[model samples]
Target chain A: MGHVDHNTAREQLETIRTLMDRASTYRRALAPAMTAVGLIGTLAGLAAPFVIRDNARSFAFYWLAVGLAGACTAFLLMRRQAFAAGEPFWTPPARRVASALMPALFAGTAVVGPLVNIHQEGAMIAVALPPLWLVLYGCSVHSAGFFMPRGMRLFGWGFVIAGLLSALAAANPHQIEPSIRMAHTVMTATFGGGHLAYGLYLHWTEKKPTA
Target chain B: MNPEPFPHLDRVIHEKARLAIISSLSATPSLTYTDLRNLLVMTDGNLTSHLRILQEAGLVALSKSTGETRPQTTYTLTDIGRNAFTQYLGHLEQIVAQFRKTTPSA
Candidate 1:
């Protein structure tokens, strides 16, 4: 028999270890938290029309409240999941996810200030902001999927596609009302429905197998 | 063939099991004993032996704390260990690169 190749063995072992590390998803990504954020998004979308009826100015603040609530929900749930897992919320994996996601989020937030001002001036620029927000959010989520599960990337892509469509609709002068409704529907489906679906999937699949 | 392509390979960290253990610990800030065992898929005794060797070599540090119900043991790579691992990986990469350069193509 040929002698065993230590170098080849070492390389194989290293490859396996690397794969395992990459495959290990961040358990603290909290599906339930995502679902909560989705619920909040749905509620906000439902309330947006009534709250901002005939007043475009209130649109910004209403969505801002939704964003804040979603952020808080995600943060609290992540903290809880981390503690339960006997790890810190800001672990190496979590930090990687955040690092990947932050640039897009910062860009979105930065653009919002200008967009809100334009909207206050009664310009159509404000109409396009929501989809822009979605596109940015989708980019962030897609980047974050690198450090998360395989399915997350698909979710991210869904947001991106929806964002593009919404933006297209918003750009059409004749399609403003339908476009606004479409944006809300997309928001509800992506944030609300997406979260619930993914959360339930995680809860079912990730639960420890009983002996 | 070169007489010694990897003269500086740290023998203590070169073993397969020990390398795996060190590599795993290096990726995280700290890992519990159970976490390591499950990750490496090694028996308690096998893992303990490797951990002991690394611990003795000052390549890994163990911290023990009482959880709400029981004591927990976690392992972290020491700064020295981190440097050593990085150096070892560099050497391995060099070796692989050299091998690829010299080997005839099929």
Candidate 2:
């Protein structure tokens, strides 16, 4: 058997600790996924008002479809990246991220049905859906931030703050009237513009692993 | 006097490269060959030899999948490997604690 000294043992433990941290770190390149989602969101937001008009039900369905599309696009991009890196798409860390994001995202989608059904009487509630969606989406991202890179939490906070501010503006009678168009505008500013800004930032700041 | 913890350590995982590999695998579900190489900054031959040693000891499992262009291989620690790592950590902590006991604080 190989003899080990105390100094050697301590050094080995420290090395193990570092290797563990590096192995668990999230290394996936997010720029592509973020940019793709950003483009989709911006385009969807711009086209929403023209296509859906004043019908609250149509508005709800349109945004839901857009959200679904954005999510699918991100998923596909991530899968492609995993393959390119010679890694599996559904690793344990990936599972952890999905688990974290699922609850808030599910709530955001589930509430849409009831909110649209009551749209005839509680039109304000329907108008408020954009902020609600923003908060829920922010919370989802924030929860999933544990398994992601550092900036994700801040990005999540941006959505949360935007949602709260939109809610405040809606509540102020002196502010612009709460309408479906107003909702679309809010969504456009926060989801569309926010994603684009963050995506661009990531593209610029992303560090390439050296050869 | 404490019995030497050195003899108790898992020899297969006690070497520098093999220990690093085990440590990395323990942290995540699995890693691809390229991923491990990049993370450890190790050469192909060195990594392959260490991985083979672990695989032979049943401390690691390897899987190969046919991709569009080529075959991709991923490696994960076996249950025995995880258990050994946990025990190794416990023994290391005991050694550290024993050292602290012998050497009084300044």
Candidate 3:
């Protein structure tokens, strides 16, 4: 039988191993940023009715705007793999739901307030907006047999935990108090910092260019 | 360690392809079905048959997951697989070492 080059074969095996590990790490780092914004948007959605209990429709509308945006972002990133190249295309677009988007939507909605003449129950509907959007976003991102390292799974579990806790608090009067922030922090760290750490660890050990 | 006077490759651990698979798994956390498929580059029926052999021999482990889209399978070396691969390397090293002492290379 022809002989095998044991030494060279071993080296090739090691090099490939490093590359796969690094790719997984890079995937981890970006996952959290995408998830956190969507998560907060969802929470804000669920909280809208309770916060602005009197104007349910207005609240629902605002939440709906945020939630829809999150779902769209998830669709662009996860489903289509549009920006998977890790270049400028990979960077997530400006989040309209959380910081500027919410205020802008609120202002726009308020301006239209007299025209629509939204009552209190109409305002309560705003709270459901983010959750509804988030549900859609989650659905869009959900896929089977997609490759994910253990780190991604950890981040996902964090989100589920956050959502459940937030729901429990939302059921009570003091839903907005402490647990929400904790969930946000945990989710951010687990997905953002967690992914970056995973990436760096893999990069340091890896022999090839994983990015 | 010295090379055994009667050194024969262990059947379960000695085959080159299976050895290559275990060696690859030892270093990576896991390899996907497609990744291993492309790496081995054997026909589906052939790879499946070999993998089944290794799996039955308890030198490899396999798992399957159903993602929202499709089912993905992954492979990893078992603890025994790692030990066997390592021992194979060590055995090769001893053979070279013995050869070097008994007869210097030209």
State the C-alpha lDDT per candidate: 0.72, 0.83, 0.47
**Which regions in candidate 2 have their CA more than 4 angstroms from the true location?**
A1-27, A84-87, A121-123, A207-211, B1-3, B10-17, B43-58, B61-63, B96-106
Candidate 3: tens digits of C-alpha lDDT, residues A1-211: 1232334334544554554443232232344335544454545544544564344444434544654565465546543432332222222222211232344334434543443344444322233222332322222222110233344445444434544554454446464543323333333343334334544554454333122
DockQ of 1: 0.24
> Highest TM-score among the candidates is held by which one?
2
TM-score of chain B of each: 0.91, 0.92, 0.85
TM-score of candidate 3 on Cα atoms, chains taken together: 0.36
What would the per-residue lDDT of candidate 1 be over residues A1-211, giving only the tens digit for each residue?
A: 1122336635745764684475344544456777788778878777766766433345555666677788888988887765665545677777888888899888877876777666564535445767777889899999999878677888788788878987787778785664345545666676667677777777776545111
Tens-digit lDDT track for model 1 on B47-104?
A: 9999999999999999997754456788999999999988877766666665666775
- Candidates 1 and 2: which is better by TM-score? 2
Candidate 2: give its CA RMSD in angstroms. Answer: 3.7
Candidate 3 at residue B101, lDDT?
A: 67
Task: Give the distance in Å from residue B74's predicted Cα in candidate 3 to where it truly belongs.
Answer: 1.2
What is the clash count for each candidate, in the order shown? Answer: 1, 0, 30
Model 2 achieves a DockQ score of: 0.50
Model 2 per-residue lDDT tens digits across residues A31-90: 888888888888988988777657778778888898899999999998887776555688
